[model samples]
Target: MANPTTPTASVTCSALSYQWPDGTSVFDGLSLSVGRGRVGLVGANGSGKSTLLRLLAGRLRPSQGSVTIGGGLAYLPQNITLDTTPRVDQALGIAERRAALRAIETGDVREEHFETVGDDWDVEERALATLGSLGLGDVELDRTVGRMSGGETVLLCLAALLLERPDVLLLDEPTNNLDLVARRRLCEAVDSWRSGVLIVVSHDRDLLERVDRIAELRSGSVTWYGGGWSAYEEALAIQQEAAGRTLRAAEADVRRQKRELEETQIKVARRQRHNKKMDAQRRAPRIVAGERKRSAQESAGKLRGLHEERLDEARERREEAADAIRDDAEIRVSLPHTAVPAGRTVLSLRELRPRFGRLLRGDLHVHGPERVALVGRNGSGKTTLLRTLTGELEPLSGEARTFVPLRFLPQRLDVLDDELSVAANVARLAPGITDNHIRSQLARFLFKGARAEQPAGTLSGGERFRAALAATMLATPAPQLLMLDEPTNNLDTASVRQLTSALGSYQGALLIASHDLPFLESAGITRWLLLAEELQETTAEEVRDLLEAAAAG
Candidate 1:
């Protein structure tokens, strides 16, 4: 699948800029070049990574400047929907050619049929091979997409994009909804990409680790990191370490300067007091005394000014040093009341069967404060199982019960009301809770003072997520059984860390459904449940091995 001979494909932007109609400036005069190789685009939420991808793909017009691609470009958007009416071959843009080939085989030597086939008489073969490469080999060429699972559709879309044979490929969060198996297939595609400019925007760590370089988009600018995610993190760690040392030195300088200034003031004050005493006691002639006093005053004034100036300069340097340090604030909240005892029976799923998805006759007993990870391939009933446990979707034929207060944060995060203020939404969920108490708790989630009163619709992605999580955790009756479905779906790396920290304070049972293994491990997941036809308890090592096995298969 790889082209060993490196191609000279590239994507370049010159003084590019973009702004929404709401006057939100995403980028201003941004310029960058992505040469042939795999490039991972990473950034915090609202950092304009997606905007840059759209501008490169020509899906969005830059407000100024230009975008230049060395060759053909194909973009795989974050959200994809396929019409069930079209056959697989048609989706791959080879239906007409396949039809023409069939016509020629039947002795219909029409000029148009030959023209359609052209030199690509093996177009169908190529299409099938590409599908097979993406683990969709069993997908029939004539079958509609309606019969396929979501993961299958994603693979189909990727297969179609590969069929185009573009020189530059742009993928925006391609693994967002893909299961473990589909993710492996996509990873293989990236691994085999030896030529052209491939830029992918994803939060998936494994996918990011496969990149040749990482271009971090921050503050409307791109900073390049050689190698992959691990390299980038190592560089950042080294930089932060150096920054910490610099900051400490700057702070020490400020303190020393301040101390010198104070000593100078004291010395000047004592000198003044002595001069005044001598003058008042008539120790010299009046004229001489006045001259001496003026001289002493001027000298003290100069000394004070000199010391003050040094202190000011030291403060400025300290400020600059502090600015160099990143603000990776973690949410530290207390959850003493949410803690459950060791003997508590939190949840029980007896012969559970969701209305849909792959989970069948699921049976599990969650006791005490166990932290469980619900992992499975796409369309494996992970979400269905969560919803069934939440009672949103009734089980088809089994019993589902929760003994303690439970809360579920679904993938969509639709728990918050758009029209109400964040504080108001939390208050609505926590009826009878005092406003003072709610505001105090919200402050722990980083919503202090006026921020708590901001409309839910106006909050940024990270802020909204924190607010939703705050509400879920800080409900009227504290939730002892918390369930999160793909909690880190669109969260940036820093935000993911913040989420993990918040979960650290959670003393109750946690049942998280996610494909992000790193986040699960960070969240202190005590047990791993792989959901398919049945929920199977597995180890983290085996869960990780699933990727390698899937790719090999």
Candidate 2:
């Protein structure tokens, strides 16, 4: 049952308009209202999900309308900006406590009792408790944020938000960097949330399935579907089918109207010719001849006007049909492949060992053409092993070698240059390629036209990944081996399918470290590398048993 007395929050927009500094309108007359409970926000890139979140959080004012959020709200932006030098405990506890004290001094907290308990030690204990609930209990509070992995940092931010206990929580792509275990932890946290409204924006279907309802945003409008991810998908299919039928009907109407206009034109021409012939044959008075000529001109003028009117109507209908079709077009991605033949030995690791502050050990060995998956808990060294293989991190006492040319895509796409435009980045990576070639390559990855010229820093998470792939794969000779770290983290379903298809068809070897179960299953992994206290190789059946055991626990 749902909790009562959670302030029923309502949001509405009337004639709302928003424009960027460059006068590009993002939303015009867009209005939406969300009540209580978990709501998933779905949209394509640049559909203004973030903008709407800000509006609901009262951080951004609408250009022409008022937005009312009637409760205490906490917002988690998609990209969190943190001071990496601060220790985790200071970042979450000490700093927050100091801020709370300052707020009390400034009269921000009206209750005298809150100011009285300003120095209470229980506050820090509560912060620790919240962190534990989010599965970060094992994390060292004294560790710097810079030393943590992307997934760990994101989890810490979520823990901080949960500790605040706001009346509403807005999370944007909260699970993007998390592994399977951490993602499950977040799901559990969201499910257990009570007395608050939660609005989440994500491309994760599994996470969306846990929400109470789904709200789809397309072309600056919100459509609500009662139920979870499956319901949203069904609704989208129905809409696409209806849009297709409308387009077909409009096309047929346009053809019929064009034919009718052509016939009317022919009739008018024949009538003029007949009148002219009759005038030439008749020895009629000047008055009668003048009246006939005037009548003929008047009739021609009215018929021409009517023909143009019909053509205009037909053009409008055709445009409407085109608009509808455009909305339903699926995102398309094309991953370029190189003709590198499979090598005899894909990757070789000898006595590889990675240590964690002298407390933990990870050792492993892997070989060629093996679809190996590394599984472990959140803090384990699964990613560390991959880094060692790529030489990003040196192994403590072992040798790792790849016989073939290798390409690596990191979890965060740090390979991309944020200051450069997308085209420039691609061009820099493939210097031998021409500007036209670079543009064509990026177009396959769905960055075309003006977007191709946009700075890389401005792209969404999915677009950034596409740009990275285009820059990496389109070189003169592509790498024989591909290593991807959580490549599907922020990608939509369509993009993921494209990548999987591309990888499956490539003749070379791939070593992917990901927690995306569906993707791994579809890719047909032949072997698995389980990373617990140490690295162990096993068959697919053994891997499944291990996963089941973990789940049962």
The most accurate candidate by TM-score is 1
lDDT of 2 by residue, 1-553 (tens): 1223457654556667888787878888887777778999988767888888988777787787777665667788887777789988776745656556557768786665465455453666777787777677767766788887667788788877766666778998888767666677678777886756789998888889889999888788888898889888888788778888988888888888788888888998898888878877897777888899899889887887888788788879878877866432223434445434333676777666764422135444344555666655556666677787788887777678887777787877887899999999888877787899788867766677989998998887667877887676665456667778878876766667767765664555677777777788787777677677556777656765665555334
RMSD of each: 2.6, 5.5
Model 1, 335-446: lDDT tens digits are 8878989888999999998999988788899988999999988788889888889888988898999999999998888999989999999998899999998999888888
Each model's lDDT comes to: 0.89, 0.73
Q: Candidate 2: lDDT of 441?
A: 65
* Reference-based TM-score, model 1: 0.93
Top candidate on lDDT is: 1
Q: Give all TM-scores, in the order shown.
A: 0.93, 0.81
Error of 2 at 160 (Å): 4.1
